[model samples]
Target chain A: MHYIEVQKKDFNVGYEYQQLVKDNSSDGAVVFFVGRMREFNQGQKVSALTLEHYPGMTEKLLAKIEAEAQERWPLEDSLIIHRYGRMEPGEQIVLVVTASAHRKAAFEACEFLIDWLKTKAPFWKSEETAEGTKWVEAKASDDQAADKWSEK
Target chain B: MITVLFFASLKEQLGCNGISLSGAGINTINDIKQSLIADKPDWSKWLHKPNLLCAKNCEVVNGDCSVTSGDEVAFFPPVTGG
Candidate 1:
């Protein structure tokens, strides 16, 4: 099973993990990732953040990322959850879970999903900082991270 | 007509979330961008920024990609979400 969602409601990580591994007795490992809003970024104190996305495009690209991960790994199941709208520091922003028959595949696929999601997804973020609210630009480091997976 | 969308800083800077352009002579993403600049001269700076990204029909695409009527095109600053 593969699950992907975008919503304003906060998610329960434990509940999501449970759902990821349920009814998959053959899977021996489950790796999940949760991304949270940071209090500081690029030398600025971030008090809050607002995330926006191209609604139809965001879901479509996420599903494509999940499909790519499934093809690259022996994944039994995977789930992706991303939140939008206003949020404060320490709040959950995104979650990714990958279940597989072994720990390595589960771990690698989980990381892959996050890496691809960073550069491929349509979501954009703006933070409330001490200076003022500003849009977050894509980082070169993120592109490098995603590029690593492309190396044959 | 081809639908165009903007997000994040571009959305705020352009002062519009989206717009529609006639498909005629709007074969490439760059063509539509030029048309936008012609109509809204004030948006030239942000619209022409080096980091601007484009997508056609929900798929990330280059400026040279073809666009047609009924297509949904989007332009935004490079993504920053996780």
Candidate 2:
């Protein structure tokens, strides 16, 4: 099963994450990832970050991503949450959790969700820094991460 | 009239979020792009970004798909946040 939500509050991704693994004693492994804002980027001090997203498309695309991960692995459950609006450094922005009967599938699928979410979702980020406010630029690394999934 | 929209980077780059256009035989995305190019040449470089997507009423679409007069067309760059 897949669950996805986009919100603006801090969530215990670990808490809901534990809930996904419940009632499935067969699952031997679960992997979770939380992405937080950083204090520095491209040699600059970051103060805050504002995330812009299409409300409807954001949830739909993420759900599709979770579904793809489930198809590739014997995943018991997957959850992805992305928070928007203004966020400060060291605050959580995204969380992904994957559960499976084995470690490899759980870990790999978790990584895959983060990878694809970066390049395929509908979110944009702008950073507020000491020098001035600027939008974060997309990186070549993100494309490579998303591309790896297609090679499967 | 069809509502032509741009989001995120595209909106900032183009300096406009969206605009109204009179839809006609200009049904496909290609037609809209052609008109936009004629109206604003600066966006030419971004038309072919590897991750750009065109959508009609929030559904992913191709450049040649027919767009009705009252449709909503959106353009956006690749999303890079996780």
Q: Please write out the lDDT profile of model 1 over residues A1-152, one tens digit for every residue.
A: 89899999999998886766566688899887999999989888999999999899999999999999989999998999999999999999999999899999999999999999999899999999888898887899999999999874
lDDT, residue A142, model 2 = 87
Which residue pairs show backbone clashes in model 2?
A: B27-B67
Chain A (candidate 2) TM-score to true chain A: 0.95
RMSD of each: 1.1, 2.3
**Candidate 1 residue-pair clash tally:** 0
DockQ of 1: 0.91
Candidate 2 contains a number of clashing pairs equal to 1
Q: List ranges where model 1 is wrong by over 4 Å.
A: none
Please state the Cα-based DockQ of model 2 relative to the true two-chain complex.
Answer: 0.68
Error of 1 at A120 (Å): 0.9
Q: Fraction of true contacts reproduced, model 2?
A: 0.69
Query: What does the lDDT come to for candidate 1?
Result: 0.91
